[model samples]
Target: MYCYVSEVKLVSLPPILCVHLKRFRNDDGFTKKLYDKVTFPETFSTAIFAAGQSENADCLKADEHYSLYAVVVHMGSTMSGHYTAFISSNQDWYYADDSCVQPSTWEKVQGTYGGYRQRSGETAYLLLYRKKSWNSSG
Candidate 1:
C-alpha cells in the first residue's frame, strides 16, 4: 500500500486564533533560523480561510473580524535570543522587555518585521488574534 495525501481545510473558527510560525530548522548537523519578513494586517477577515463558509459570513460583521492584540517576538539568532511581547489593550499598546514594560505604539510594533536587522527589528514568532465582539443588546 502507498500513503495518500489529502488537503484539509478549516471548517470552523474559534473565538481566538493563535498562529505560530516555524522559524527554526534543523538539517543534517546544521541548525538554522528563518529571517524572512512577513506582512500582516492589524485587522483581518477569516472568512476566506473557512471551508464552506456560511452566507452570513459574507456579511462581514464584527464577529467575523479579528484584531491583533499580542505578538511574541524573538530577537536573536537560532542559538541565542531573547523573547519579548507587544500587547494591545483598550486602544493602547505596550512593549514588554524582560522586567520592564513601557507604552508603545503601532509604529513600534511594525518594527518586528524581521528581514534586515535595523536597531530594534525583531522577528515575530507567535501571533495572537482576538475576535471582535458585538453587543447582544443591539
Candidate 2:
C-alpha cells in the first residue's frame, strides 16, 4: 500500500477567516526585507487561520473567539511581489503561516504593510494577507 498527501491540501480548511490584502509601493532603490510577529497572551485563547498559500499569517483561538493575524516580510518599494494582509470576522474559511507570533501582546504589522508598531529604531517589514475564505489547501 502507498500513502501520499500534498502540503497544498493542508491548512486550507481553517476554522476562522481573514480579509483581503492591501497594496504598498516604494520610491527608493533599496528593498527592505524584514520579519515580525503579533504576539498573543498565554491567557488569550483562539484558533485563527489564513487562506493558505501565503508565507506569513495565522489564526489565533481563545475560548470561542478567534483572531487572525497576518505576518509579512516587507521588502520595501525596491522589491516586487504580493504584499498584503487579510483580516476576518467570519468563521467559515481561513489561512495560516508556518511561523507563530511571539511575545504574546504586540500585534506585529510588517514593513510591507507600513507601520510604526515596529521597534523604535528598526526599519522595513513584510505582510501576510488575511482572508475570510479560501479554496486552496495551503
Candidate 2 lDDT trough over 10 residues, lowest sum: 37-46
Worst 10-residue lDDT window, candidate 1: 54-63
Alpha carbon deviation, residue 37, candidate 2 (Å): 17
How does each model score on TM-score? 0.77, 0.24
For model 2, residues 1-138, the per-residue Cα lDDT tens digits are: 999976532334345333323333343854443433333221112233333334453333212332344443333343554332222223222222334322321233322233455443222232223333233322
Residue 53 alpha-carbon offset, candidate 1, angstroms: 5.9
How would you encode candidate 1's per-residue C-alpha lDDT over 24-127 as one tens digit per residue?
Answer: 88988889877777766787776556646555544333237778899999987778889999999887889999999999998878887767555553788898
Q: How does residue 128 of candidate 2 score in lDDT?
A: 25
Clashing pairs in 1: none
Global lDDT scores for all candidate models: 0.76, 0.33
Give per-residue lDDT, candidate 2, residue 93.
22
Error of 1 at 61 (Å): 9.6
